[model samples]
Target: MDFSQLKKEIIEYSKTIGIDKIGFTTASTFDELRNRLIRQQELQYQSGFEEKDIEKRVNPALLMDSPRSIIAIALAYPSKMNERVTSKKGERRGIFSRASWGEDYHLILRDRLKKLEAYIIERVPEAKCKSMVDTGELVDRAVAERAGIGWSGKNCSIITPEFGSYVYLGEMITTIPFEPDQPIEDQCGTCNKCLEACPTGALVQGGQINAQKCIAFLTQTKGFIEEQYREKIGNRVYGCDSCQTACPENKGKNFHFHEEMEPDPEIVKPLLKPMLQISNREFKEKFGPLAGSWRGKKPIQRNAIIALAHFKDETAVDELIEVMNKDSRAVIRGTAAWALGKIGGETAKAVLENARETESDEEVLVEIERGLAFFK
Candidate 1:
């Protein structure tokens, strides 16, 4: 069987199925990335989200027996929303980063991979394959970098020359001995823009990120946000785009190729006050399709309260007070107290003074003090 011809056919087939970019590479152990992961763990820089087993992440053979090569795929998501919603005074909106704008990318990429897998198995009946998107153990960026999908950029994203850094990556480890493509040359020479622009200094250095400081990772956590970074989160409800937006390589590089990736403006940039009180089912109906909703409504709601604080939106003060006085979740209730203090008025101060006597949770009481401290 001519594997080279089969690889060519796979590339052609990939385009028909809405895959924006495709590349192939050997299923070699990612030794460098393994070292980086160890170092990130040592510094306590790792977000607890990643797969903990380092060997499983680097070795393809562990994922699937005797995997000969890996195929990497990328799909470009739009950096700007097409259907623009109007923003006006008295109504503050929270922003979800571009990565989480449209439909959840994991499902979209997985659908593409499932199609590709079927195509490969049709021709080579004995072909064995395993695939993963972001949730998978293998590092998608490491595979894409080696597979020539794109150069690994300083912002810790795989930046395709054509798509900039705004692309979703996925990979398939297979037994096919397909020839590998040459990797792209790094084009981010002498550029410190992404590092300088990071709100929390999450970009420890070019091509390295301390995920603990990354706003994108922090937004997904269910716990209360640390006070120092609260203001730095700005109006971001989910994920952070500062580093990607700061990259000059991404200049004028927006693409609307995938229909499913187009965002609904009102949902992605929904009003902050309404988010404070949105129901579980209501949150699902509006944001469930978006990637940012993966952690469920609590994190998003908590971030919304913080965004209201960031804006100092006086109009949201009433809603913030309600959340502080009535919300069941201590994180939500405490965050509302914090927001109320940030947006202080006679009413905000009164609510906190009352809550100080009634609030029971140790963590909530601490946040109440942080809130009241803002008044001082």
Candidate 2:
């Protein structure tokens, strides 16, 4: 097929597959993208992966063994409901980052991308393509920008004129030598609103974000959070929306989250008392399919305890004590101790003292003493 005919067919096929934005680019556009990945790794933005692991991302060929073109796609994830007010206050509620309110995007986007890949194979037969939805080694946002899907905002999120930054990104690496789109100029001029609005100052002067300091990253992390950073966690149990919420460009835009994406009311706004009382089995059953499930029960339970402490809800002291004293997970105990300190009272003080006596974990012991000092 001629290049002009190929581009037209590709765009039409992508739109038919439910993607709001589609762009194509030569795989070689990643020459500098590799350097940026090294920089991000040095800055500790990538949590699970090491610097060497990210080096592999620079090679599009590594993503699909032999990639000549990148077909980047984006799906808008609008939030129709006022997610902020969906849950009542003081409930040990678990708020799903709006991205995960309904059916998992991985399933939806992967299915759609698979259909598109099948279509390409049928047309070109020799056209080899691999589907990727925020997975694999390709730098999706970088590819998205090269494909003209959108410019990367100061917050490092892809921003399209039609949907802003509230969208899911996916890509297909293929042997098809399609025409590439030039990246649009960045529109984030002199606006530090997203940076200023960060509750924990995760965003820096440039578009750099210290994800280690990001509340979104801290909350979802599996283990005991450092005591100093605990207070900054606020009420966010999963992903944080502060940066997106503060962006002026997103102002007045209508949200339209799919019906299946709506968060489970129980998951959205769970009662603290019940949350503290549930067993691991119950936690797994409730949050298994949700984004929060990846970290397991301890991190979430810890966040709930911290929320109770933040709200100064002393009523949770007894439940927190039970977990601190008896729960097998050291992370949960540490969080309970942290919460007891935040919600100081006689019961909290006594529990703190008792936990300090028997706790062997150095981190949990430190949190225990911090709780004890709060009551003193």
Model 1 C-alpha lDDT versus the unseen true structure = 0.93
Separately for all candidates shown, the number of backbone clashes (residues 3 or more apart, or on different chains) is 0, 5
lDDT of each: 0.93, 0.76
Location of the lowest summed lDDT over 10 successive residues in candidate 1: 81-90
Estimate, for each residue in 243-329, the C-alpha lDDT of model 1 and write its tens digit.
Answer: 999999899999999988999899899888888889999999999999899999999999999988898899988888888889999
What stretches of model 1 exceed 4 Å from their correct place? Answer: none
Clashing pairs in 2: 78-257, 92-272, 93-270, 101-261, 102-261
**RMSD, every candidate, angstroms:** 0.8, 2.2
lDDT of 2: 0.76
